[model samples]
Target chain A: MTRSGLRGLRAAALTGTLVLASGAFAAENPIKLGVLEDQSGDFAAATIGKVHAIQLAAEEINKAGGIMGRPLELVTYDTQSDNTRYQEFMRRVLQRDKVDVVFAGFSSASREAYRPIVDQFNGFAFYNNQYEGGVCDGHMVVTGAVPEQQFSTLIPYMMQTYGKKVYTLAADYNFGQISAEWVRKIVKENGGEMAGEEFIPLGVSQFSQSIQNIQKAKPDFVVTLLVGTAQASYYEQAASANVNLPMASSVNVGQGYEHKRFKPPSLKDMYVTTNYIEEIDTPKSKEFLAKFKAKFPNEPYVNQEAENSYLALYLYKQMVERAKSTNRDEIRKVIAMGDVCMEAPEGKVCIDPKSQHMSHTIYLAKVGADHSISFPKVWEDIKPYWLGEAGCDLTKKDPMAQYTPSNPPPKP
Target chain B: MDIATLAFSALYQFGDAFAFLVLSACGLAVIFGMMGVINLAHGEFIMCGAYVTAATVHAGLPLPLGILCGTLASAFVGVLVELLVIRHLYERPLDTIVATWGLSLIATQGTLILVGSTMAGVGTPFGSFQVGAYSYSIYRIVLFVAALAVLAALYALFNWTRFGVLARATIQVPHMAAALGVDTRLIYSLTFACGAGLAGLAGGLYAPTMTLVPTMGATFIMEAFVTVVIGGADVFLGTAPAGGILAIVKSGMTSWQGQLFGQIGLLIAVIIVVRVLPKGISGFVLRERT
Candidate 1:
């Protein structure tokens, strides 16, 4: 053999040994987690904050010593608020990226779209957004506060504060329709009667007729389940027509951040139930807001979904630590074992083993002038009751099905 | 609520609804009816006016001046759009639709880029007063009066002015008007600018009552297109009756049933109008063309 050939062989053998040595070094490599969120479409305003919050959590987790000994590497895809994109990204995260866990989904519709993919691939999905509730999937864990946890406090309070007669106005969709049904049930339970109920279509901005009808109905308060920036117009229209009935919603202040979007007095006196708000006086919240604002100075606002997302990662990290493995089955077992907990910005939150939903502390917040929020009261460790009522037992995992309001008094 | 109060409430709703319908549709009527160009960017024009008004008002300009600036900005943008795109595609109405749709997309995306998704709006100007058990908005009443004023002003512009006559004549017989010492291009441009200005004015007036966003145009476009189509080719007369009829049907059904039924009622009214009078209300109301 030539002298140069012998030297080349030695170099190749040395590199191979180094590669093997590094491969044996367990903590040298990183574990991948997926973040699929709507970054630039209709849901962007609400979901973008969630993306940042999760990213912030990942950074903090790495700084505080990541899961086991490996640093968590986030593989993100912006779903652009498209359902098809959500399904595509969900599949991609599982099959292509092979991420250990996925923290994603914004709207309930998008969650429904990609949830089956997680099951198909045997992947773990952590959904971190407040929704209409009643999702009982085994492969997914929801960290956001659900409607049952919110409306249980909000409805009775509004009914007691305002008169016995209530008017319900909601967007014509699953979230709106289902929540409105809950309002009706709660209203009846509280000895309050619904004077009138109406569901406005998702994109309908012209509310002259609806406003006029609201005036004629003369309800003591209007419970709005309206969603989206467009539906936020109801506040302006209602205020313009001087249909000055008090208003309350579970979906408003937290998701849309309407208090910030709307001018003062428009959202004044409006009540909401949410997981977290900037106005929260808790030390955890203040510290979190300070950190988040420091990291993302130009961020418009951090919402409930964002806070839930930040906590979701820690919850997943807890499960992973308990399981001592990134294996999906092990993590699933740990999650289903229940009692997964995190000291969240909103307060202490835990996973309901039976339903796989968050037992979150919900605050009944009122919008003050200048878009300040005041917590009139807080409902501690509120559990998701709607799913249990719908026969969802996550521990069994025999069958998973979504529950929606079945018997709504026809669309108005 | 008492019967008198209910009746008055219904009347106010009808008037307010009519004004909104007319304000959104009138610009389209002028553009589509006169030029036979389907200006798909009409709503974006209105959005531009709204954004300008919002910026000015927030910048400490008086409300009236802000509105004027908004209207003028819309007009200027309208003239620019006409000069750049519509001028070349004058005779091709279908092409105008496609081109203007592209323009609409550009305008929407541009606005989204410039101003984020949501823009805060001004507080509603006037307060409320009780009408029996129900309180009514004075601003809505003002909206009704604004609509009437708009109609009257449009009437004066179209019927009494030399520019309006020449413009109408040019659109009716472009070759003849060109031969008779009229600049048809200028007339067309001016007419298009006027339509855009009307849309801007409507947008500025209504901006205070809405949460301003780049996509705000989408909400107005469908109603504007429907109302304009239902009004037929006559700008003023056709649109007024169509707005009144649709508004009455919508508001009445809404009061009796709900918002869904009200919208359905409006659609039903339009279908009935289209089925009976293929050329719209103007075709029926005026047997002889202007």
Candidate 2:
């Protein structure tokens, strides 16, 4: 049979099933939640934990009899660390599995790839990653730290603790390079000079010279943005050289993976900014930690993406309970109107009324010699940098909200 | 600018990028030049090599053994490609490109379905042996030097060895070599495997610098195309050094200038050079003076 005929048959079958089960759909139909992420590529370690955590959340929710008497079904698709795969996965989830909600795509690149498709189909995508933010869409919610929230909170604190001079490094990509630009602005505005910045390719080695330059510049602190193991390698080189510059990272730089470079001395006294801590002073965090450890005891280390996905599913449950339906339009409306606040352990988080993003609290923690991410401080009231001073009003020229205007325009 | 500082800084950025680019370019050049097979699935061959290295290392195999098995298996996979798919497409360039591209997609998706969608990491098992001030991952530097050695050996193989001479003769005078009782058809398979083996070698070497993803092979393939085309696909020696120079300049420009402009400038340069010299400058220079 031809493909169109197969598609037609499937669509007809879908319509017939929906019509017959319309009355029982709310209670009996499986409310499929698509958890799509970079599964087989560069981001698996950071994101697989999230997929497993979401599964755990689903199982626990299902055992508790799910939201509003319906079973919470979780289906996962790995974007294979490619943008094209993300689109394909989204299609398979929406059309094939016919999921009600999805935690689709991580990283700014994947999110950008998914936004238009989600918007076109009138579905919802809860993006859970810290990014250089300038998002404007109703069907999307930015759960991770936007530039203003993550940078403003850390930069001033680092400057006060270390000094004004800062050195920057990041992966050479759309997200990392833009983030480095923001860090430079944040440091300079707070009475500091950017002492040379480096942008390594997506996967490059040999940081000897970048290390030497940063050491020679004598920067009081470093705002490192490199991700994956390159993030770990850069830190290892620095720590070994005894470059005691107080460092901060938007990426999960000094996690267990980085510390594994050598035994201990290679990755000590490093810091990272994230939303969830394995040791947060909360009952929920404690309970979640134990449960997560039981599930992922072998890979006991968890990153923010894992926590974000778990919380998102639970939040979807709460919203489903509050709204009393699985209507994508209604959920989209409820999220955009910002009437729902999750029982977030990091703190109570609600979607920003206008941006349609969650108001997540960002935390700064230092990795100790034993490889524990120690959060000594936390910042609430997180907002994007665009809403702050450096935000450019490009809405006029970019009336459709597709193009972005540069802040502090080009240096002649 | 102080040329030493500028060149040194550029070289610092250049080593990793060039190592990666040249590793694949060297392989593709050898295969395409010697065997005349398009081999679009070459990147996947490299990817399989890295994963084999990772899996073997994870399975409690020695690091050196893992590297050895990975490259051998990669070469084996190349032979498999030669046997299953490309064996028929020897005379069809477009068909070979299409078939290999499909194979690459299948391999990528198959990897996703089997291993998972997350990135797997490989490490240097022997640990680090650093010099005084300048530190390096012993494994990666070892790979870098190994790549050079392999290139030198390959050069000597083609220039000084009987197999190389036979292979060269097969290319230069296929009809004459066939009349002289040379098994020209067998050389194609052998050369294809050797080229794929080099890609695997590059992948195994690069496994430590960053995470190994199925898509990684594709990224390096793009670099391979750039280097191979610029270096002179027909000639191995001149193409590699020129490609290395280009890659370093491309990566180093991002540090001094910005990523966007640096890349844009590199693109423009590549376009202009290609326009003025279609066969590539290296190709023009490498041509016989007579």
Q: Please name the candidate that would achieve the greatest DockQ relative to the true structure.
A: 1
Q: List the residue pairs that clash in candidate 2.
A: A39-B117, A39-B118, A40-B117, A40-B118, A41-B118, A41-B119, A44-B118, A44-B119, A148-A385, B231-B239
Model 1 steric clash pairs:
none
Least accurate stretch of 10 residues (summed lDDT) in model 1 chain B? B109-118
Q: In candidate 1, what are the lDDT values of residues B1-290, reduced to their tens digit? A: 47898788889889978988998888888998667899999999999998999999999998778889999999899899989999999878799989999998788778766777678787778887777867767887888898888888888898999998998899989999999999989998899999999899888988888868777777788778878888888788888899999999988987788777887888888899899988888877788655
Interface RMSD of every candidate?
A: 1.8, 5.4
Q: Which segments of candidate 1 are over 4 A away from where they belong? A: A1-36, A40-42, A62-103, A116-123, A324-327, A404-412, B288-290
The candidate maximizing TM-score is 1
User: Model 1 - which docking category?
Assistant: medium
On the 0 to 100 scale, the lDDT of residue A392 in model 2 is 29
TM-score of chain B of each: 0.97, 0.87
